[model samples]
Target chain A: MLNKVVIILTSILLYKVGGKLSLRSQLLKGILEGCILSIINIQPAYGYELSVKLQQFGLSDVSEGSIYPILLRLQKEKLIIGEMRASESGPKRKYYKLTEKGQEALQLFTHHWTLIKGPVDNIIEQGGKTDGSN
Target chain B: MEATEIIELNNEKRTRLTEHNLKYYEDMLLYIRLNGNKSEQQTEEVLLEMLEHLLQAQEEGKTAEEVFGDDPKAYCKEVVEEIPTEKRKNQASLIMMVILQFLGFFAGSYGILGTALHYFFDIGSALTTFSIGSGLVILGIDLLLLGAFILAILKWIKQSTFSKKEIKSWVEFLQVWAISTAFIGLIVVIHFVMPSFGKEVSIPTYYLAILGVIFYVLSFLMRRKQNF
Candidate 1:
């Protein structure tokens, strides 16, 4: 009985802590923006297609509707430009492409990601080694 | 086969699509308008993107709610908050409003404190006994409150960051301030001019006050109507 009560209490505590850890969402958004810039760095795509591309790359949490805001932000920053074009499928679609600045940003993001990935890999290889003996 | 037939068919298709999704679009627009403070053009752009997304979703045999989730209002609010607009004039006006409101609050408190000191503690000037100093203090308080109200209306008008046209130029703003002060000056002039006018056309102070009150109410209503 006591074991079951402790288990229930610990689960509740973890649930509360999990909900409070949404600060990582900001980190995710920054990384997602860089990923989006890199995707557009390859080819221009509309909002729906860009989101589908993200999903194809294993970003299942990004909804199609949510991508438009990021596109708007990029447009505002002059990092991307969107133009309305008649589509073969349906109505006119706004296709977005990276500007020269966006290309530079994507390159910087790639360079920084490469720099961080090595250190992160090293830490993970060490397998939680926190001892001073090294 | 004919050109007109193709146009009519397209119109029918568009109307049918709109009719099928009218409730969703209306709810989304209303929510964004109420909560996001977006301009008409911005709202229309958002709606166009949503319509395209909805059409694409329908083609895939899914409702917009299924694809984009059920809460479009919250979604639109989140989207609108992310994209910042260039509104230097609005920012300047907002800062001005804040400063003026701060000054107005201080002036009102000072006036009250001055009057209270005179009435309750007899610590103020002897000129207040003749109601000259006290009347000026009261007028100062009224002017500050009215100025704050006008600034509030200006701030509300300039909230549309999408529009380049400012609600008031510096010249127009100064004109409003001058004209309002001149009304109070008119009352002072009337009080002095009453002696020369004799008993025939003497305007009572209360009558002038009533006229001022009517003018203020009418102006407020007119301004609100114009903005909305």
Candidate 2:
């Protein structure tokens, strides 16, 4: 029991340390998926609306400087396509929609995420206790 | 929190964001705005988030008195840091290649002068013209060999993204080689070939050899640096 307790504490410590280390990667992964899902959950989106949604997930690193590169990369990869639509605000805004490939990728990503989330949520709900093995 | 409530975002604050990292910050904003379920109660939530970032900057010991402190370029630089560096070596290589070709052209001219000097000048005028012609040929060849040095420097400059010192070193290295080659050529001609054929075939034979060496050296360097 004592050894188990010690193991749990060490694992939690590692989790805390690692969370800080992988903050950017985690934030980017979360926001990227969230954006993709937002479009799938809806249809298409412009830059402004997507930017607002990314912030709500506690990701502050998604500045305009950071996000545009990812968008460009997605376009380059042929995962998404964009078209310009006139906005009530001022100029036309670029509205992006998932490509066929993007939709396929989103489906796979969702399936894998669901699989990974199960054990993860199990641990979270059980307060990190498991069946005597890692 | 009502759906009817509207909020105004300060255009000046929003316009301040820019980066050459292919619109990184823009993507970030767009992602948040589209995905965030912020209600109208959070009407200016998007703008407020950005405002909070600026406010946090002050809390972190940023200047309180200043309204907007950092320049747009400074923020742009930060964004650029997030992206990969551009391909610059190919550009530098092309520039160096052009310069090398020019040097080869000059070297070819020197060879022409060496051949001409042997024919045009008697022993009296031959010595001076011969020396100058030989020197320039070697100088041209030296420029060719130095092209390799330019490649190395270009590699260094591309990796560091600053300092053109490597280029300067290449130029100086080539200059030294040119001078040295000229001196050696003069010595070889005067000692061996200058004494033969009653001074008729004398200057031409040795001058040709020296020009040949210079051309050979240059050609070797040029072939090595084909810019491929």
Candidate 3:
């Protein structure tokens, strides 16, 4: 009986954790385009390479396929341009490079991000303090 | 690369995908391709890029759902929204081509059948009177209904893309049969109910057939020139 109770409780906890991770992904969607632009600003990259880089930078919550729509949007806006280049391992890969417009856009994103990040950080930190004091 | 070249390359690369992944990827392909106003070259280019990404992800043992997300329809919608639309002139030319082709086929078939019945079987008149006003109305109605039918079919196909439940073959057959029957029935009813007005022109069935051939040839030339 005790083992059954522990198993049931553990499953519920795992479910909640899974739900939280999905919620985090939902939140990440808003800033994913900016993140992509910043990465392309660093250096030219392809779709798979961009996803890998994002994962390397601790953005595992963003799905590998999710970056594609953002890439399309960026290309449409003329912020980045994709050119087909030969790859060593396989068929040709479309490498995306940031344009001058993209550079300006990335700088603007950084400014806006800095503005929002500091206040949000302070609020969360102060809210924790108030809870502790209470 | 040209759109045709990209399409050829895509066909070759797609065979490398696992069956499940191919199904997912093809759904996205179809959904994007069905969108008529988008730039064909850009669409094909993006599709090829997507196929490459999927292939790489597959090498790492990741399923399409893992890479593309579970909501394939929503993902496709986002991609479609971002792709550049075709130029207004190109879109107008395409519509004109379709209308011409439709007119050619309808007129050609009707003329041929009427001519055969009149000359070979001694059944009907070789010359028929067509009213300018009613003919235009009928053509307009046919075009509108055909457009609506095509759109509904496309919507149905897109909706089926990530559907969990399998739609039975019989149900699909019945749906297609019903829609086709309704379409034909509506056209026939319109032909009879619409009042004939304006100028009446009497032309031989063979002459009408010749005119249809002319329209068809014009449309074919336009298609070749435009590369649509």
Using TM-score, give the best candidate's number: 3
- Judged by DockQ relative to the true structure, which candidate is superior, 2 or 3? 3
User: What digit string (tens of lDDT, one per residue) describes model 1 on residues A9-122?
Assistant: 433422223433243444455567788898888888887778779989998876667676677777777888877677678666678899999888778777766765575566
**Residue runs of model 1 more than 4 Å from their true location after superposition:** A1-21, A118-134, B1-22, B34-40, B86-228
lDDT of 3 by residue, B113-188 (tens): 8999999999889998989989999989999988877777877676766667889989988887887788889989
Q: Tell me which residue pairs clash in candidate 3.
A: none
Judged by DockQ relative to the true structure, which candidate is superior, 1 or 3?
3
Q: Model 2 residue A12 lDDT?
A: 47
lDDT of 3 at B72: 87
- lDDT of model 2, residue B146: 53
List model 1 lDDT by residue over B1-228, tens digit each.
222333343344444444546555555544554432333334445556666667667777766666566667566667667555525554444444444444444444545565566667877642212244444555555556556655554444334322335555776577667755765575465445433321233232333334444544554554344332
Interface RMSD of each: 5.2, 10.1, 0.9
Model 2 C-alpha lDDT per residue in residues B1-228, reported as the tens digit of each score:
211221234344444443321133343333333311222222233233334344444445533123122243343333233233224664454445556455455545655675566677732333323344545455555555555555455443333332224456677678657655765565455444432222222243444446555655665575466423
List the per-model TM-score of the A chain.
0.73, 0.63, 0.73
TM-score of each candidate? 0.48, 0.36, 0.84
DockQ of candidate 1 (2 decimals): 0.19
**How good is the docking of model 1, by CAPRI class?**
incorrect
